[model samples]
Target: MTETPGASGAPSVRLTAGDAEVTILPAAGCRIASLRVGGLELLRQGDHYGCFPMVPWCGRTAQGRFRNGGVTHQLPINAAPHAIHGTGRDVAWDRLPSLEENEAVFSYELAEPWPYPGRVVQSFELTPDSLRLTMGVETADDSFPAQAGWHPWFRRNLGGEDVAVDFSPVWQEERGADHLPTGDRIEPRPGPWDDCFGMPDGVDVALTWPEQLRLRVTSPTPWVVVYDEQPEAVCVEPQSGPPNGLNTCPRLVTKIDPLEITASFTWERLG
Candidate 1:
């Protein structure tokens, strides 16, 4: 895989705080390659990276089809039968110039198949115990529907300890056979879920690995999708909207206002 510079000329970026460390790859969709807190790895590091940025839109768009301003746009179905995780994960992002050791930013512009002219900015702020992620999308010439978020695939176990999830979302969005929300919000069900959920207040989830580590995920957004079907990893995604949200609850980014969201993951050593 090709690598990108941390700034204008640096090959890569690494942030360190206490025993915590983070590696950001600007070329690989500006994704987080690794997030290690002490001797424990909190993220699942692999070909997809530990975490990736989902921009312009989060999740699927219903068979890769959506209508805006009377124009129908079709996106490439990267996830089979649907366009998933937005195009940001498949494109190159420009690393913004910054001198901070614990912060990095990357930017990307909308291109073909998206049928929109806009720019997306993603930033990461790292501390001794947490990583704050922020994303924003905006169009200068026209208003375009958009969403933003992160997909962090966390390891199911840490230091040989099984992971446990704890959260209380307001409702679960019943998923259809195609994995799209059915527009029905029912009581939250027990995982392994690959569905979106309503968080009337905000997104807050805690994951604990007994005798290993404890971590908390928080976002101000009202929607979150939790996927725990995998034996190796679990995903607790926070986003501005849900799957097929373009047709359900579209958030338009105009010349004056942009769609922006922020989420933070804090971890602590246990045992």
Candidate 2:
């Protein structure tokens, strides 16, 4: 494991496994400062999901108006009038004890009276071969709705090369221009893709580089969202819900007395 100085100038922990180098910021709620695998970086800077990356509402919130539990909630537009991700990414997190060298646990509580009333705990682990991230959220009320996912920015390399990705299952199509799902799915042909996908168990997603480097992501989650803005990097986000999930799955809007959700991804380098 390697160590680096954090934004606070204090000693922060950094772990290097094979071609992956991860920096853990304990003071900043144990946020993942950087995650690079096979020389490809994922997880955008200044972007987080409270501790990881918040989904359900990734990107914009659409004027910050959405229905929840048959009631409409007006969320502040952090990025314009859109909700943009969730509250967890911007909130502070507390560090927890762990025995794994590359494992980190963070905890946060949104009291009953808090803006986003829910208790959440997140864990991030990076191995020499892969990365595993998980999150659990519990609420005091049995009616609060929640969605979770990771937002990592991946590098496309310096030579401006196109990376190819392979998924086990077909891709899901979006219902609207806002990138919401239409409850319909399709196979990924040669075209622009910016939507969630349903992956089969133990499915392998590979990022083949022109420089002869291959990065792979294997996970239990059935859905993966491939996001790219060109010339920067691609994001292969594994999510429990599609973008604008509340609008897509109204039943998921209800609050939970105590809810727990877990999602993970593994990254490895190929010869």
Candidate 3:
């Protein structure tokens, strides 16, 4: 995992308020390269390892295919059998003006491999206790299905205790052997999970590093995918929809209205 500097020769953007600090890489998928609270880094180190915006779509679009208005469109399969994440994460975004130093915005226009003309905007804002992430997508012409979310790879250990994940999901999306949901809802199972969970009341998950810190990840989105199989990090992702949502639960982004979603991570020192 490498942490990339901003576009060209530009340095990454850093925002500080109180004891919290945030580093963002606009050229590297507009991911949060580093997040520190109470003088301890919460996110896993590296460029591709930090939290990144998953826009237009989240997770995988099964077999890289979807239908809009009765027309079938195929996406470039970057994750073998499916298109993982989205095109937004693989391109450099253009920075937009912000009235405050603690907040920055970046935008990218959809291009080839996407089969649409649209714009995606991602914003990162930091306060003393939390970091807020907002994402939106609006099509330039035709209406299209879309989704937005965040994938944050937080460190399992905070140099003290390994982080513990806690959350109550309404149900789990039964995963098929191919790794896509089987369209069946079942009881939430025990980890190590690489599955998506339902939280119709909204997503609220906690990560605790005993005697170190506690972070609460919250979002109004009803879907979340938790991946804890990795030895070094734990991911708590909040999404606007489920994986393969393009085919099963499409959220339309049109010229009149755009699809938008937001998530936040708030933390407190613990003993």
> Residues 105-207, candidate 1, lDDT per residue (tens digit)?
8899888867888888988888989999999898968787888899999999865767999999999999999999988889998988998988878999999
If the candidates were sorted by their TM-score against the true structure, best first, what order would they fall in?
Answer: 3, 1, 2
Top candidate by lDDT: 3
C-alpha lDDT of candidate 2 relative to the true structure? 0.61
Best by TM-score: 3
Model 1 CA RMSD to the hidden true structure, in angstroms: 3.0
Q: Which residue pairs clash in candidate 1?
A: none
- TM per prediction: 0.94, 0.78, 0.96
Per-residue CA lDDT of model 3 for 31-61, tens digit only, reads: 8888988678888987578888887789999
The predicted structure with the larger lDDT, 1 or 3, is: 3
**How would you encode candidate 2's per-residue C-alpha lDDT over 86-165 as one tens digit per residue?**
66665566767778877777777764222455567777777766667777666555555556666666665634466776
Indicate the residue-level lDDT of 83 in model 1: 90
- Which runs in model 2 stand beyond 4 Å of their true positions? 1-4, 8-11, 16-19, 26-30, 37-52, 55-62, 79-81, 111-116, 158-160, 183-189, 200-204, 250-271
